[model samples]
Target: MSSGGSAQRPEGLGTRTSRGIYVSATTPGSGKSLVALGLAEALHSHTDRIGFFKPVVAGTTPDADPMVALIRSRYNLDPAVCRGGLTAREVRKYLAEGKREEIGARTVDVFSEIAAQCDVVVVEGTDLVGQDSAVEFALNARLANDLGCPMVAVVSGRDRTPEEIADAVDVARKELQAAHCSLLMMMVNRAAPQHLDEISAAIRPGVSHRPVYVIPEIEEISRPTTGEVSSLLALRQIAGRADMEREVRDVKVAAMSVANFIGVLETGDLVIVPGDRADIMVGALASTFSPEFPVPSAMILTGGLSPDEHILPLLAPAPFPIFAYPEDTYHAARSVSEVRSEIWSGQRRKVASALGAWSKRVDDAEILERLNLPRPETMTPLRFLHELVGRARVDRRHIVLPEGTDVRILRAAEILHRRDVCDLTILGDDGQVREIAGSNGISLSGMPILNPATSDLRERFAHEYARLRAHRGVDLPRALEAMLDVSYFGTMMVQLGLVDGMVSGAAHTTAHTIRPALEFVKTSPGVKVVSSVFFMLLPDRVLVYGDCAVNPEPDAEQLADIAIASAETAAQFGVLPRVAMLSYSTGASGSGATVDKVRRATELVRERRPDLAVEGPIQYDAAVDASIAATKLPGSNVAGQATVFIFPDLNTGNNTYKAVQQSAGAVAVGPVLQGLRKPVNDLSRGCTVEDIVNTVAITAVQAQAVHAQTLQAQAG
Candidate 1:
């Protein structure tokens, strides 16, 4: 990761320095919006104070750029600030009069003003097109340098060969670098799936210094919606207004008989014919509801003809849209074929699919590190939870919920299933769980429910548990008796690799929930004691409180281990760790057994993890409040900006977290246990559906990291 550009402070823009990233393309139709959308969505995980700008929009209106509208609506950006700096016509007119420098200066001024309000801004460049394409590309590079932001170039690989793809990327990279723009990354969009290896191999050696992402072609994003087609031909919609957003994957002509046309139809096909062809229109409308025949997206009546009175009555209840155009059938079909599909605000499914595809194909963490933008001062709770869910949905892991009969657990399972966050298996009697879910109006159709007492795995699991616990004097009969417990059964399943992780404790105590894992799964190698942390989501930022639910009182070594583990947990969830060892007194103002223990623990942490920043014997006020920090410990780095707060004892940690959570209206999402060999997280006994969902998501992400580490170890 490298920050390759010099800082520039433009006049009249307040002292606040806002970071910006420029997303541009080598040519038109490179799917630049997809990259921008995914980048924005990814950035939202880190911070919600984001702004979007287009330096040169094609039209004058604020809504002229569909990309801007899509981003604003999806991310809830301020509408007043999410507009282009200048229109295409305006830029062209200025350039024709040789005002190139004026264009760059104006862009810089507009971008800086918007940047002042946001932590970061994503600037989109004009598409490379028209007679001035060469000039436009050159201007894009110059604008990036003028703004002092890093650039990411998107190259189209839709119909290019491996050599062509490499050459195109090289040319774009050289152009941007020559203009003193820090090229952060290159994305090859719409490449053939089968040729991905060849294309990547050809381009990697040339652009080895920077990360290159290759996205295979997805056809769903290339298909225009019915509403877009209707707008293109200026057709008057007759019925099915609600279905206008349905995608049109193919275009078909209904010149033959109804029987022949039905045979030629395909799913998402747009049927075009004269209004007099009532048989074809009726047949196409009926096919949309049939399971056997392919469904048409919509039907177009050409030649400016209206359907007969009898036909209008039949089309009133159709599920697909019906449009009337003044052009003939031939001209209408030609126009529809020439209309290029694009992602717009109205087509949510397409935008979501595009984001998902880009997320799955690209390495977002690597890109963010390369850009190395400044971190936001605070993160909202909603944005934090949304990022957790998004990370869990990528390469999903199977998780088991032991207390299935509990209503909260069942409700959480339903929500997780609906969101497709993870694969779930519930432990309980299937019939009873189903009955309870039915009465609560919860759907558990796809989730597997099993009774520990009657499941076939009970015998096998008992045997395996007895063998693993033989050293602890466990017998086969004892193992069989223990397997009847849901927590024990679920833990054995994880040990046997049947599930990736386990979440229990909604109806049980913390000891009961974690005993099974301690007996078998145990802690990771070299870990002396297990610790836990609660993510206290405050109004402005996230804070980590350690040992709140685990150790009652830890010695210096245990406390140091707890601090290290807490810092790692915070970083895993996207918060940069700045360890603050909290005590009743700040610095050397007071001396006692408690303060001495904290001072020792701080020393141990610094000795063990030299790379981490640790501050100790600090009062709560001095640790968090900037003014108090300056008065108490003036030169400390972690005094006022600490993200991870470690308490000397459980009494302080538990009560402080509760006080802040209640008094400040914060969301405490944890007792996230660390140092486990496999991910087995415990929930609060009085937890809500949202709490269970968030804990399960966190567990899934932990399992993913463990799996990656195991693969890396094996390869090494």
Candidate 2:
């Protein structure tokens, strides 16, 4: 649909703005519109208040514009907002008159109306056909900047060499940068089948921060159905009008004998034969019912052809539509061949097929993550989770869910799998898991379910467990029994590099989940104690509290390790690490055993990791409140700006985190266990599905971080 907004909003339209992503194309026929549709569908799954906008639409009328009508109907977006954009004619007129800024001004004026009502608007750029692509490209860049939305650039790869496609992508990136438009991701659509790998490789190195996807051309999506042909060609239907929606895959001119024509018939062939050929009609109609024969899409009888009245009864039950034309067979065949294939909003079957193909090629989760929307001034729980999930999606990691028997685990697994946030393997009896999932209306059709009891890895895992714990006198029998426990099996998977991480404790104790990991996975080299951190999402920012879930009665040395690990964890999740070794007193105000332990821990942290910014022996009020810190610990770097707080022992750590979580209404995302050889995170036994999902995401990110560190160390 074209621009639907009036010149301006009604009385008192303030300057409030909205967040959105712009879908722009490198050239025409780039399938950018399809990407917009897929994006709207993806956003709908996350929220219902979704909006679709086009800065410049192909047409002005909603009925005349298939894409805008489709978005409005499919996503239930307001038609007015979907149609709110400038027509190409209006944009060109402004540009031609040296009024480029006018184009941005008018578009933004319209966008403001749409953005005012919706949480996010998906803005589609201009179709590059019938105009100079350079101008259209420049216009897209300007409009994206004016609307204050990041872009997902769709590069057209069809009919171009890999080198040319790469060149186009580079040009798009440069132009966007020149206009100061932010890029979210790069998608190359309709890429040549043979050159997919090359095109994808060439365009990615320059934009490593963004995810790149190369989707090969799908033929079914470009084929028009019989109904579209009938509507476009104005054919008179003879029979089976209901079957006109069948696709016309190929065109066949049957001017030969019945036997000869039947031999040439192929599936989805639109047969154009002369009228009154009873023999030809019978053979074609009869083949439709036979399983062995190829099914024709529809038959077009030319030269005013109509079967004899006596044969009308036999043709009434035709599986495909039959149409009559006033022209000859040659013209009818030409018309069928020239039928323009377009993804119309009315064609539900074609739209569904197109979306399925689009989804297969495009990872919407990664795209959403790359958006990295403008953050709020305050770090709310929702915003923290958003950032967490986004980081995990950018590079997916395989995480095993050990507590597959728990309904919450199953549901969270399904959600994670469906979102493509990461690859997940569920450990349990396959049948029972599926039965529970099925009974609960959860679709685990494509999710991988691994049964540890019957798996080939069981024997290997048991042997490895025995070997690793030989000093503890664990024999094959004892290790084998331990391997039967899903937690042990999952931790073994992480240790053996079968999976990137493990997430459990949904249906087990914290000890049951962490013991296996501690026994076998152990701690990374140079790390003295295995500790945990809870990401305390306060009203203003996210704070990390360490040794909250593990390490009971830790001494000064162990407390130092937890402080360092927690600082690293905070930095890993995009928080600035200002370490605060919290105590019962501020500075040297008190001299109790706990205060002495914290003071010693702070000294140890400074000696070991001089690069870390750590301060300690501080009270909670002095550690957090800048005004109070000024009164108590003057000129202290981490007195009031701490993002990582290390507790002296588990008794203080656990209770403090819990108290803050409940009393402050803050979201405690973890006790995310850090300093492990492999990432194995534990969840609360009473955790919800959302909790499990977040923990798995955190684990995946930890695995990624660990891997990067290993790589960097090797290179060093």
TM-score of each: 0.61, 0.58
Please report, in order, the local distance difference test score of every candidate based on alpha carbons: 0.82, 0.78
lDDT of 2 by residue, 363-457 (tens): 76665554433323455555567667767877778999987778889878866765557899998888677655533334465778899899999
Q: List the residue pairs that clash in candidate 2.
A: 3-85, 4-83, 4-84, 275-305
List candidate 1 segments past 4 Å from native. 1-18, 79-81, 178-180, 204-208, 393-395, 398-716
Whole-model lDDT for model 2 versus the true structure?
0.78
Considering summed lDDT, which 10 consecutive residues are worst modelled in model 1? 8-17
- Which candidate ranks first by TM-score, i.e. highest? 1
Tell me the spans in candidate 2 whose CA falls farther than 4 Å from its real position. Answer: 1-387, 393-396, 712-716
Which residue pairs show collisions in model 1? none
Cα lDDT of model 1 by residue, 1-716, tens digit: 11224443221122223388888887766888788888887787666478899988876764588888877877667775577788888888888898887788888888888888877889888788777778877778778777876677889998999889999888876766666666667889989878988988898444435557888776767888887888888888886534666778789999899998888887678889898899998887654354456567788999989999888888876667788888899999999998888765446556646765776678777766655556656688867887898889886999999998898999888767755678999999876776556433345768999899999999999999999989999999999999999999999998888999999999999999999998889888778788899999987789999989999999999999999999999999999999999999889888999999999999999998999988998988888989889999999999988999999999999999999999999999999999888999999998988899899999999999888888999999
